[model samples]
Target: MSKKNKDIEVRIEETNRTIKGTNYVINQLSIGKKLVGEVMTLGAKEHEAFLGDEDLGSYKSVDLAIEAILLQHNLHD
Candidate 1:
């Protein structure tokens, strides 16, 4: 967490869930305990990013998915 973005606090953590034989970890993006988005692995190299209930898009990696979620959340700082 950086102090530069003081308006909201962003946090991502692992969840106990797996799909399609992929032991994926769902990162819940939250702002001060309020969940705004999520990122999870679909299978192989495919990852899914979402905001609220809307699908942001499919990504190739977890980092990319997180980036998309952050961009959609407008928390790029």
Candidate 2:
């Protein structure tokens, strides 16, 4: 594939998580190290608030970001 085409591609991986007592759908993109993005399609205002806080903002890489999300859900077990 061409470099130009690669830049337009977005690969997403889905996982279930819960933040602040509500379940959320987490989407992880296979992009650059610091290019992690997330979307929570199911949750209340508190869940969104927690996700936007400084504790979640400390992750600097996509892998770490995913890890942080997993940790939030206690999914590591």
Candidate 3:
């Protein structure tokens, strides 16, 4: 099932910065005013989700990552 952006307010911000020699595109995920998690760009259409310091695993798309975040956090509609 696909999640619709109806009841929840989701936000994704890209942190364009390179650490060491790797180009890190950290997308900060938030709900309302509270930060829920982050999605790190692994490659083209590949992303890794994290809640705080715990790795949530890799996803095929950003939407999948966000869905995982919502499910894990019990915030899905």
- The C-alpha stretches of model 3 lying farther than 4 A from their native spots are 1-6, 75-77
Error of 3 at 68 (Å): 0.6
Task: Give the alpha carbon lDDT tens digit for every residue of 23-77 in model 2.
Answer: 6766654444433446444423222212333345533344555556545534322
Error of 3 at 3 (Å): 20
Candidate 2: misplaced stretches above 4 Å? 1-9, 32-35, 43-77
Evaluate candidate 1 by giving its C-alpha RMSD to the native, one decimal: 5.2
My TM-score estimates for the predictions, one after another, are 0.71, 0.38, 0.75
Q: Is candidate 2 or candidate 3 better by TM-score?
A: 3
Number of clashes in every candidate structure? 0, 0, 0
Quantify all predictions' global Cα lDDT against the true fold: 0.81, 0.48, 0.84
Candidate 1 has a TM-score of 0.71
What C-alpha lDDT does candidate 3 achieve relative to the native structure? 0.84
Better of 1 and 3 by TM-score: 3
In angstroms, the error of model 2 at 22 is 1.1
| TM value for model 2 | 0.38
Per-residue lDDT of model 1, residues 1-77, tens digit only: 65574566678888957566767778888878788788887677888898888898899888898888888777633
Model 2 CA lDDT for position 74: 44
